[model samples]
Target: MRLFLAAIFISLAVGFVNACSPADKAALLAFKAALNEPYLKIFDSWKPSSTKCCSDFYGVSCDPTTGRVADIILRGESEDPIFEKAGRSGYMTGSLSPALCKLDRLSTLIVADWKAISGEIPACIPSSLPKLRILDLAGNQISGKIPADIGSLGRLTVLNLADNRISGCIPASIVNLGSLMHLDLNNNQLTGAIPSDIGKLTMMSRALLSKNQLTGSIPVSFSNIYRLADLDLSMNKLSGLIPGQFGSMRVLSTLNLDSNQFYGNIPSSLLSSSGLNVLNTSRNNLEGELPDVFGPETYFSVLDLSYNKFKGPIPKSLSSVRYIGHLDLSYNHLCGTIPIGEPFEHLGASSFANNDCLCGSPLRTC
Candidate 1:
């Protein structure tokens, strides 16, 4: 089945999840009914081989030892969500129930994208499900401050609440989700400064707080999230120097800080990210030399450093990146002879557009 369970790839000890008790299996059955979408034909759409338990039901994955549902994927074997067929859309809007806390053994709950769900998130989310590891509630019309209580779900690994109408400042308590690995709260109506201690989520691999109303300096502690893989905070009201520690995230792959009020040179550390693939910091007050390695086949594949006050020779060693596809370095004070080489030849002239003195292969003359 193409039903990939990305959240299942965790660092949990193998021995711990190998066994499940019968009682746990029963809890899982009841939890299924408690989960949202009671009217949806998903669980009831087809009669499973066994009626006693929904363990082998569609979108359900059970612990092999205990025969209890460990994961719930609402998609069918055909790789299609039951309700989202080509010519049809669902409109079974209703309130979410607090009874979902019964699924004590569940590690992931991904019901956010369903267009039919509306109403407040279950406040009992944190207190009831101690073992909950992943909670995705994106692309919903969910209203209300995020239940501040979710901070208690220490075992949570991924919390995605993006594209919602959620308001209120991100509570300071959110920093307490110690084991959180991915937090996506983009495109919301959230207000207030990016919390200072937000960097405390050391286990975070991806964080997206863009397209909101947040205002403040990028936190220094942000660099402390060594496990961080993606950080996007664009189109906000942030000001001040981009945090130098941003380069400290050794595992960082994507860094976007565009459309902000940042000043000063981007820390060279960010330029040297070994695992970085995408780097975008356009439309800011940045100054100084851009990394000398943003050329052809460097570590990053897609880079956008346009619309900044950067002044310096373009880095000449960028011909190393063979996988580069998109490069936008226009609208800067850059001055240099673009290397008329294989890697540079493959890139578009827009990459060197609006530069004061950029010349070479991307252009006909200097």
Candidate 2:
């Protein structure tokens, strides 16, 4: 009977040792103590009584082999059953704990959309979390500059800090993220020119940096990002000629440079590219005749060139395009009869309105 009791005691002791380590547990507790998630009680599961933090803790996951915490995904906007049960979204108000940097094994840390979670992002994250692959703290009230050493995370794939109050110039070291794929710093208070070598992120597919105080001409190196599909530099103070090299990008389809200070003619190669479907250069200082490079292969879903200084008649070549779902050429110095073709049949006078002397079936007769 004594032998049996000893065996059972040994088994229990081993199980306890295999559970979350003491240091990790302490770090997690400190991390939780900083935040208050009142509605869903998400932290209720993160209790000292539940020793197996790997399986028992909410929004926390650990490696099966090492029992080390690997991920902490807590989003305020989730369709989790907890949100459904509460009939509302998650809401947490507090600062992120620096203790999170203690979880050295953490691979993904996403505490996003917690509207009131305000504080500067812990600067030690990039150095402490070497295994981090995804760092999405977007849609929070987090303020401060992005970590300068963010490029140290060699395996990072997604870095989204959008819809926040983050300020300061984008760190030049950001272009060193060789594995970064999706970079979103949209709707932030970011200022200054984008990193000149941003195209060095060869694996990047979408680069969204709109609605900031960014200035400087579009980088000529942007054409080097062969995989980049969507590029939005809108609502900024950027100026200079839109690079003609942009027309050569093999996969770039959506290019938005609107509401800026760009000057010079629209590149003909941009209109000639068969892959580009959405091009908006509105509210800029761009002038010159519309590029007469449209062909049967041209297919633009949205072509907005309004509110510019473009002069000259509407390009007759535009009529040869396969499709142009939405075309806006208003508020320019364009004059002459609107080109009559299948592409222009559905367009209304508003498209050609406010032009210097434009006249056609849509507008008053010439």
Candidate 3:
């Protein structure tokens, strides 16, 4: 009786093993064969003989009912111990395998933190993975233009391809990404003007495109991104006046447009923004008086408006800010008495250096 029951249990186990899709297993094997895994032996268990494709692989998960691949989270570098150990040498090389698109049910595909994954992203990826909600290939060596039809991935909410070798203009088709919220393509070799209709991404909260070769003026349509909270376009070739519509972002907190070629007066709407905390427009061609809109509730902590062409007295309202940790108004045309406040007193003369005419504690008295 004991021997018969053991045999029945073995039979049930074999039935469960057969439930995993053969196509998904074949795709995983193809992907493994494409990678150069000399240092990272994480795919040792991806044996073709093993029937448990989903359960035995290092970064694969499948739905129990359908036995289809649901997530492929093979992160090379991260704070996680397993990923760090696998990518410790930072040498996982090879082109991305097109076989990855065979997993029909895949919703999340994150292969980030591997700086050695070279070559162009498969052009068919956008059409092949319609169910993908989060596609992050950040901090890799992937080169080539962003897929022109990337907007077809309607389900994607977060698209991060930052810190790569991607070049060419951002496709206007990306405006079709209606559900995208976080779009980061910073630190790349991309050129050309920002798409005029980028404001169509209404769900965007953080749009970081700094440290690139992007040129052209701020698009007037940017006023449509009403939910934008953190906008960083620093260290680029972007020129033109800072858009006054940006001040309308009620939730905006961090705005870094430093090291650009933007000219014209600082927008009054931006100066009066109550939600702003970190504002840096240093090294621009702006010319105007500093705004006197600072209030007790104003969350200005880091105000860097240095190397501009402002001309006027330092605003007395600067004393109203309760928490200013970083302030630099040096190298401007301003002529006035420096405000002697808590944070201002702590600042050095360098903060007010190279101005046309300045006086008070940090400098010689007028």
Candidate 4:
């Protein structure tokens, strides 16, 4: 009787495995499709069934009760999806059928540092996958401009579209991403002015819009972003003054405005920006002397004011900047005498190169 009972128990286990519903079968199809996907080669050997646990699938995760594939993590994993056959990495080139939208419990979707995924992002991305918390399409070949209807994803928190060929203006509808904490759109071909209502993204912590063709000055409403920590607007065609409203930001730390066409003086109030530590105004058309408002005690570091039209005597107050390092004032109209200060004393004429009248310690005597 005991031997017969053991045989029956084993048969029931096999039957239970065979009786899994079509949902599990759909998951397996998706999983097999993911295996051949150039973006998922890192999981080539993954066999979730072998281990009888979702954790066995290298980059795939599942919902607790439904046991359906939900989250997909492709970045910072053990192995990069090999592109030896396709000649490019992260090449997830296939139609995103509505089947992908069925992942109702999905949360995060990271595809970083992959380069070959082409074609439009899943059209149903925003409207169907409402539970998505993070959506990173960074470092891919995604070519379409950000979908103007992106606001449909009300639950999205992190949106990264950096390092792509995506063109067109940032859609005004993006302001609808009320839950967003990080939005990176750098290193693309996007043009047009930043939308005026960008301040509506009060939940953002880090906002990157560098290396594009975007024009116009930053909006004043940006000052209201009390949670903002890092703001990068460098290497675009953006012009106009650094708004005084920036100084009002208590949490702002890094502000990069290098390699733009921005003209005029650095706002003295921002020079004394209490929270500011890293400030770059290099390769612009800025004029005027460095401000003393950035007291010696101020925490400005990594200050680069090089390749601008700034003229007049070097401010002695700058010598008090004990924390400053990597100071580059080359190729400016600054003249008169170089300040006699600790680090300034070591800088040579090369550091003040191409200046019309800069003389004394750094350069030759006037």
Candidate 5:
């Protein structure tokens, strides 16, 4: 009797390891049914006869203990052996099926760069997938508002939806993403004011939202993010004074606020920030004498301040900067001799073109 009982226990353990949850298999099949990827034949291995859906299906992973689907990583632009054999990138046309929410244990879902996946993000995702850590569906044609409850994903760290046609105001609750580190929404059709509490995302390192229709003043609260390194809000309709606190950030290296409706003097602290190296404020209503705040720490790869209402002589402090790779002060109302320095030696006439009464080596001598 003892030997028979031990054999039965061993058999049950073997069965547990071999069996795939029927519900998870069904959910995956429904998800596959909605999309069509003809070239790669990626889903061909998803067969009903296979008992191990976890091991059999392409781009699917399952938790070993519970036999539940855990991840679905399928990138259209990849260096996988399959893409190398096919000699082309992936192209799929279909909506993401809501059945994906049935994978309640899913941790990471990345179906990115397909270029033609058109559909609103499954609204049920936030509430249904509590364990999700990385949700990336960028480089697609997906449209519609970001789910309002997106902040409910408490464990999410990377949220990338860039290069899509997604529209609508960034949800206010987005500031609640306590664990978020990388927030990218570039090249979208989004509009409205950035959340005033965006500074609450202390974990964020890069906040990129360029090429949108955003409007509003730069929030002073943004200075609270000490880890923020790169902040890009260019080509938007944002107006109001440039935040002086931006220069006080701990690790901020790149600042782009060009082509907006901002008006006021360029913040002097910005030109003196030890870490900031890239600055562009061209094509706005900014007016005043350029700030005389350049120092030994001033090192810029690109400093574009053209197409504004700046007047008076170019600041002599600019000549003392450590380096200036590309400088553009054109189309302004400035009148005086351009400063002579190593930083300005390589600049051409176009760098100072169209400025009123500006005369020097690059321009006509005063």
Candidate 6:
């Protein structure tokens, strides 16, 4: 009787192994077949004999119960020299495989930082992968407009397409990603104004859109993202008043809007905000008196407002920022005695250079 029970248990285990979906097996094979030689080597473990794709397939994970592919990550190891050879670059090469869409259970697809994958992102991905949560194709050579259909991936949380050659206007439909938290499209050729409805991403915490060709005023609606902590929109053609509503971002840590055409006084509310760490608005057309309201509560470490039209005396309150380390007030129209103290005394003449009639310990006597 014991031998009979053992035989039954073995048979059940074999039956479960045989139950692996045939359709998923064919789909993965088709996806691998689409890639070229050196790239195919990355998947040496993917073999015909390995019927259990969940265990044997390279960079592929499967659902334990369903035996369906759930993740596909084919990124190259940058630290490995064998992966960086000239013509034999160890990274996966070729356009994204349409066969990949056949895996109905796929949730995370990240093929990034390889620099070999070219061509557009599969247009059908959004509809094909309804459960996808992370779609990172950054640091590749993929070009062309981001498909508007991508917004259909309502379950998405992290979308990173940075460091690519992608171009064209950012689709307003992207704002539909209600669950998205990190949106990075920096260092691309993206043009046109940022979508007016960007504030719809109320859950987003960090947005990096710098080093693009975007233009027009920053949408006023962006202030709605109260969870935003790091916002970098530098190296674009954005113009208009810096949104005063940003002061409401109680947790904002780094705000960089340098090298744009933004004009108007720096928002006094922003200067008074408590948790700010780095504020760089240099090389713009900003014109106003530097606010003297910063204090011990305001823990700014780097303040760069150089090469602007600011005019006024150096603030005595500047010394009150106990953690101030990097301060640059040069190339502005300011007239007054420089503030002297621990923070101020540590700064050199260059920090206050090119300003109008600035005199004190760092310069001649006032």
TM-score against truth, every candidate: 0.76, 0.94, 0.91, 0.83, 0.93, 0.89
- Order of models, best TM-score first: 2, 5, 3, 6, 4, 1
Best by TM-score: 2
Residue 350 deviation, candidate 6, in Å? 3.4
Q: Tell me each candidate's RMSD, in Å, in order.
A: 8.3, 3.2, 3.0, 4.8, 2.9, 3.2
User: Which of the two, 1 or 5, has more TM-score?
Assistant: 5
What stretches of model 3 exceed 4 Å from their correct place? Answer: 1-19, 83-90
lDDT, candidates in the order shown:
0.73, 0.91, 0.85, 0.75, 0.91, 0.84
Alpha-carbon shift of residue 42 in model 5 (angstroms)? 1.8
lDDT of 6: 0.84
Q: Which candidate model has the greater TM-score, 1 or 4?
A: 4
lDDT, candidate 4, 8-27, per-residue tens: 98876654443333454355
Lowest summed lDDT over 10 consecutive residues: which window, candidate 6? 78-87
Residue-level error in angstroms, candidate 5, position 157? 0.7
Off by over 4 Å in 6: 1-20, 36-40, 78-90, 363-366
lDDT of 5 by residue, 1-366 (tens): 999999998887666655569888898899889898899999898887788787778888888788788989999999999999999999998988999999999999999999899999999999999999999999999999999999999999999999999999999989999999999999899999999999999999989999999999888888999999989999999999999999888699888999999998989888888788888989999999988888877889988999999999999998998999999999999999999986889999999999889999888877
Residues 9-32, candidate 1, lDDT per residue (tens digit)? 432323334333445544544544
Per-residue C-alpha lDDT of model 3 across residues 1-366, encoded as one tens digit per residue: 999999998877665644468999998889888877666677787898988877888778877667788888877665666656655743567877889888768888888877788888788789998998888888889999999999999998999999989999999889999999999999999899999999999999999999999999888777788888888999999999999988777888999999999999999777777888889999999997877887776667788999999999988987877777888999999997888777787899998999999999889988
Instruction: Please give the distance, in angstroms, between residue 98's alpha carbon in candidate 3 and its true position after superposition.
Output: 1.6
* Candidate 1, position 172, lDDT: 82
Global local distance difference test of model 5: 0.91
Per-residue lDDT of candidate 6, residues 15-122 (tens digit): 555445788888888877766546536667778777777667777887656667888886654444445654354465677778878887889898887777788888
Point out the worst 10-residue segment of candidate 5 by lDDT: 11-20
Model 5 steric clash total? 0
